[model samples]
Target: MILLFAGCPQSSDKISKPGSTQSGTTIHGEKIDISETELLTALNLTRGSQSASEAAKKIAAQTGKNVGRLSFTEAKSLAYDDEAGTFKVKVVGKKNGKNFDKTFNVTGFTHPYASPPQSAIQVEFKFDAGIEENLSIDKYIEKITPNLKAHLTFSFSLQNGKAITLGYDNDYYELTAQVSNSNGELKISPEYKLKYKKKLRGEDETSVSTAYTSAMPVFTGQKKDYFTEKDVFEHIFNKVKDDPELIVADAGSYASSKYAFAMVLNNGGTLFNTGKIAQYVNVYNTKGADNHREIKNITPAMDNVRGGGITADDYEGKLTVNFYISKAEYIADGNTPDDKEKSGSYTVVRSGFKKLPSDISSNVRSVLEFSLGKITDGNGTQDTWKKRRINNTALISMKYTGINSTYDNWFSLNDDLKITGDTSGFYLILNGQDYTSRMPNHQDNFLVPTNGDENVKILIKHLQISKNVGEEELTIRVQFMGGNDTETVKIKPQSY
Candidate 1:
């Protein structure tokens, strides 16, 4: 059986830095010079997927301080300062059910600290260690396959004080054979193995998948401040009378396709004005469906702030709007001049204004936009103009590479692309319409290079264009230090 999987890239973005110069007094009123090696040992004891409270006890014992019931939520890093002869370890969690913040500086060891390699949690398939069975290759395959599967069980505790078990009741196991000789004599060789597929990513979901054991936070449901279907339509009807043109197309007709409308609020105040803007646009197609529009509140986390730099509290917020439109719907709605006049469809044009918070810096507010054309063709037809969006923007181009061959080479826009110009800011304008929303996909859309010479690969899953589209063309506009640059590229349709 053929199985498709979307893999996640390891995060290379530098986590928040640990405070260096803050030297605190020890319990006995004595100064401690914590060595890097000792600090790393303490951090490793309380790393993620481990018992935080238990590790905290061990750490307190090692450091001879009252570290107290320290709960480990995320382990940032452990760096040694040769000049200061101290190791700074950044950790974010709770102590005694309250927020705890501190860096341990152990004295004694003289060697620099060596951090352990970061890795994803591994899942293993273990046969009955006691049972000894002699069977042919066919029998072995049959026993391990879904046809004659054996239940696997595991349990883990969640942050909310709940326990969950897998491979029980409705949960079953499915195995895929990876051996070279399926018909050969049965042998349990270490080289031959079967990989697990969790079916986490949906068929139409266009983004990379993180490993089940990844440390990154997973967002399962709609954000806390998202608008409901009723909320969306109510706002639309309230504003439709004043701006009749905003009701450009029928939401019912376009709801069948895989599209989305999103709004992002970054460094902004509240969701009050954002809901009003949704109503003013009148873009929803269905009366009460959740798929139409998405609203996101982008704010810096408190844990990421170091000393007194730029914290989430400093900036108000940034608001972005994203409206998804299919090529057929776009043509049918007369968004394109050529098709608009030929289709003889009435066009709706609407605009809204927002007042930036007085506290926000003027330099933070800048104009950035992106557009795409010939996004989809239903007839399986190809066109010369049907290519990736490439322009003078950052002197970069994109190509539609197929799925990853190995986990190490997984596709990640954040890991690959290297932008080196004076870039003020950039935003993707969904639906190829200038007046639409600046909805950004937090996982894949906003990308910044980690290094200068990094060769970034643009995977097929990262592009917003649907694989059903015969030939997809995407354009991106980058606002550099000097002027705006627009670049477009062509991508051939391929399944992930």
Candidate 2:
């Protein structure tokens, strides 16, 4: 079947505000509404199919309880049926060592296929401990909620013992197949498989798939009720098949796609393998979705300084420190003005150090450092990184990092969380002004002028220095202001 799926990227921005809605909304003035129907339509599924109901009923039957329906459900489960064409199955399981109520509402329906269109019932369920108790489950909840363990399965067979075409998708990994003869009896057999991708340097694919099946059978025509591997696979496969994304890899495709797929499977989602044809699924989509960057301001806190030496009057005027930061722009490769694919943020932070006379009293240099912690993204998760393991750039600390109060600097920025990527310029900013002039070797010392060019936007300025020789404290006030940001810093004397 030609399934047209819309791959939408999820907003990683963290909403510190607890009341933030989980709907498709962007922090940066972007809003997108993706209804469950729209999502199902995107995955090329029967828009009105009560797949979730079927899955829920199968789960209820396995757990031995009548799990009810949810008012605000995203996806519907499969269903099951009894001899009289009535589907009413329930399953019961312990959660956190306690009993919780889970209901299934799988009702058999008539469809067009064979003369008396075979009534097929399917169901799905997952064992969830809690949001926190299950880390993998929580990740899924964060991405796709209500906390689920593994989706259970159930299916209906026809007169010829042929199972109908059914599928599932967690929007990442999926499994689908046309069973030739499945109308015999209900059987459950748990199976396991490992999925991997081919990595560079002949390395194995960095993806793995874990399968768990509950060997419980409901329609074995036996007094004892239990599920077999087939039932378990069918149970989990039904919900998983709904995702529609489970696909094979195409050469030259982005590796991030594999990472996204692995994440889905790792989070209690089942995947199906459709031999012969490859599946091309979108893990994330920026089009028609709310995905924006979030920025925050975090000035330096808990400050302390240190002294290196003292002067004639038993004073330490030679130990002065100040904090500063540099800003610059980068031209992304293959990025055009119309593309709007800029991938880095202008970071601002604070750092400082004491000034000590280097060699002969004539030459002096301040041992200062700078920090770029002022800008905080609403998404507090640490940067997702990949180490390049290649060293082609020089490493320097805060003070010596930027230009010496001269020459505008820049640094290359990219979405990759590695610092070893291609770097851009490193311009200097003196007192909230761009140091555009080249560093001059003039014998006289003068306050560096700021670059007021249209390209250079003043981010911070109005820096002042104060010192109390007696208390061994040095206070530096930086009236640094920025576009959509601002901050101040103060440092006291201490050890190195």
Candidate 3:
């Protein structure tokens, strides 16, 4: 059965600000002695045994009357009142140096990798804080007003982590944040950057380091930062010249998800190519009009622009993406490829937004399941549950359409149920040797086609168990999201 799995609080909002960690005691300011951890605990009392109230009490007690200007507040679970389908985050703070408490409602999602698999991964909603989706950053903020102000929406993304890896050096991870007003207009996006570097120690040892201001470009102040292609679609639509502009809007257009851009650009009556599309992007390549933030090849990136640099957030956009389905799912014979089920143009960012094929569900909840029987040791020992070279009791039949996999999604039971040192997404195979997308969960699209004579399949492969505080006969439930309907399947692993 699916239950609340909270061991070590398997999730974190992780909203860090422009501050120093050189602790003498506070975070944003002194006298404000609270870490992000304390802040989250105080904000979300549902996780612990504490609650602070406001009426005549300035700061209600959590432990031995340990209260400050800000206090441990209240929270409402999903089983209570909420329209946006999110939990309530109430905080008591000073509005203008006075007693103020407001419950902030939030719509957030737990990345499957971030939480225990037995729990409802969609406990809240939305996807991970990846570069792939345009997720609502203010999931925990947007609703707060009065005494408390300031909300920060942040995304942590590692797009092509090792951009220029000369024997593992110069790795960059992007942190995007936006400040929203009441009208949701007149906002600013400050790109926080984290750079990773490794120093080789002899032949077998190496150390790594990072800094947010490590290699930041001096492109702020009066120096005008430009907008990316995605910034045009999301923010400045009027400046968009042609359909090609919108086609190249997503971050992945230039490098990774190029197929969708190439296809859509050509169909829009422009003989599209990299050089041809870069011409349209050139419109924004100037001081006043450019994609400085999203400009990959630029030497030093614009970490924090004063204002206006809406360059391509090109992580994910569905200007248009077509799908190719099997004959059995299509139901009808088509004269051309475009006449198939998902053959038409689609503005698909999050599935079923504009259009989607009925058979080609974006996320197939368990259309299938397996009796993920017991997992044993390498020596096939049922005596004790321990890690061995190979396990005797592993659910070899964790098959979803029987993933005809050539993939060895191996992981150490050490980190986040990681697949080959990475704990994010599985491979999405498409034409021309894996149109491999670093798909953020519930954000990017997944298409399945038989590889030559290989059968179309998606297998669970393996389930990584870390600790011992577990449940029995874990029924894995998959929620298949369609254009209009939602289908759910719970797979109860049986003994093979």
Residue by residue across 54-138, what tens digits does model 2's lDDT show?
3333333333322222212122222222111222222233323333222233233221112111334553433221111212322
Best by TM-score: 3
Candidate-wise lDDT, in order: 0.27, 0.24, 0.25
Give the lDDT of residue 231 in candidate 1: 38
Task: Estimate, for each residue in 341-458, the C-alpha lDDT of model 1 and write its tens digit.
Answer: 1212222222221222242222212222233222232222234333323332322222224423222222223211111211111113322332122222234322222111122211
- Candidate 2 residues lying further than 4 Å off, grouped into runs, are 1-342, 350-445, 448-496
lDDT of 3 by residue, 86-186 (tens): 23333434322444333333223111111111211111111112112222234322332221212222222222121211112222233333334334222
- After superposing candidate 1, which stretches have Cα over 4 Å from the reference? 1-33, 40-136, 146-183, 187-496
Each prediction's TM-score versus the true structure? 0.16, 0.16, 0.19
Compared with the true structure, the alpha-carbon lDDT of candidate 3 equals 0.25
Worst 10 residues of 1 by lDDT: 255-264
